[model samples]
Target: MTLSSENCSEFQYQVLQRSQTLDANCLLFLIILGKMLLNILTLKMRRKNIYQNFMECFCISLAFIDLLLLVNISVIFYSRDFVLLGMRFTKYHICLLTQIISCTYGFLHYPVFFITCIDYYLNFSKTIKLPCKWQKSFYFSTVILIWIFVLAYVLGDPAIYQSLKTQGTSPSQCSVYVSVQGYWFSFSMVIILFMAFVASWPDIYTLVQAIRITSYKNETILYFPFPSHSIYNINSKKALLPRFVICFLGTWSPFVLLQVIILLFKVQIPAYIELNIPWLFFVNSFLIATVYWCNCQKLTLQSIVLPRDPFVNWKCCFIPFTINNFEQIEKPISIIVC
Candidate 1:
């Protein structure tokens, strides 16, 4: 078993290369799982009439595209064949393909955000909407054009080109491009979540004391006890904040933990996979919440309408406390059990 030094070095190299490839596969698998979960949640939470809004259209399209891309990647890995369209997709080529997607996705982040914001404004303000006949075509064209523009932009960008340039080239190594954007975004999100959790910590008990589920004729309703002198207001983020913290943390705590782990380990994830639907939704929720918080006065005056959230339903939280004369009050109420 006494081997030559050259042979031992070669064996070690093979082992290291295998490890790297395995790591890459595992990372890709995790991304696929996350996308699957997001797709399911989106569909479950989506309204039955999806065409009611452009945001839903965009959401469905993006989820489908992400799923399609991941499926394509999976097929290649499973078949162990890198050929497609009579062309070969070697390690570097596959990595390049994914990086292109990541870059394009990253670039479109702000555009999509602003577009959603505009969508909300128009819907809430009851202003400028396309005729029903033209709505679908209009939104479709917009989403398509946005994708085309971002893809073209990413391809032309010199920074992306520079990032794709390699340090070392070897058949055993799969080199993928990454950006500081992923790290910075993840780190910032972790900080924001931590702060939000801390700020909501003190108000948790007071929020709990003001609500209860009551059964009447076998139908249960989540009744929030809002007395004339009490603190919970229907319009304020103060009352909404704790419920958001509960639902948000309940649904996305695992993803937040993943971000924390990635940050701690300094994982260099490609921006393409890193900037996903969940992250975008997280940003969307935060932006909407910030707007509401800043306009608490307007909210109290009934000027601002709360936008519909695809993931977290703001409609679930309500108040109904100090009901001495229940017969005198005639208010619209929901019957939700537990």
Candidate 2:
């Protein structure tokens, strides 16, 4: 069939859109699967520790939320052109689901963050060690508190109500769009809280003292504590502080600041702003996995299976299998008839 210019443009747009949606779904699926497998493998390898178990469970929950968000986005995109098809599905239902999930995951940030900080504090403080059962109870209570706070705040905020009113773009398409004003307030609060938490480090005595003497700040990197030093390693206070800052600021710095600026300046943020939110999520996920892998010896052992204690250097054991595979492939090639 011959295609007119209008038809060709429309067809190409649909194909491009579908291709992008499929890519996102595949990437999200792989990430979720990788996380789940890693968690299972880790659990099998090591006796469960309280912090580790909480992290694994929390990650699983986050993964589920991510999966839900992706599925909703996919459905919306798939039905974009056909209002009747979209109407049959109802965007409002999906949008509500997304909002709930979004709020759930957003609130989870505080507790997870607080727990990480507390974990570091407890390790450094040399306080009385609790039994695993007690620790589990404490962790659950913290999570409950987090959710309660989220619900309470959401209920009080008039923004959600306003956003609900504007739910669907067309009869076919629904979205819970946060008012620009509400978005700014919520975004600012998170940034302020994050900064406060980071600033609560009293033991940053050295860094603070160093800051006083460092003039011009151009040589600041040289003056700051480097990770390689023994002083930095054993002290959970020192080690975790940097990790927390890197994670808290690095992953979120872009989107948070962007929102704040957009709100303060009363400028319309470019379409790219919405796109960055998901990109930030991906960055945060990768950063957390990397941090856990690099710092937590207990976590690394669980990512793979082995006969003996895998902590005894897993890389050394894989060489023999790799060599055998290479030899087998070499022999097959040598014996092949041209």
On lDDT, the candidate that comes out on top is 1
Candidate 1 weakest lDDT stretch, 10 residues: 318-327
Give lDDT: candidate 1, residue 265. 89
Candidate lDDT scores, in order, read 0.62, 0.43
For model 1, how does the per-residue alpha-carbon lDDT over 22-120 read when each residue is reduced to its tens digit?
577657767776877877785676445323455566666777778877776676556654666797655444455566677777676667767877766
lDDT of 2: 0.43
Off by over 4 Å in 2: 1-54, 67-89, 107-111, 168-338
Residue 92 lDDT (model 2) = 38
The candidate maximizing TM-score is 1
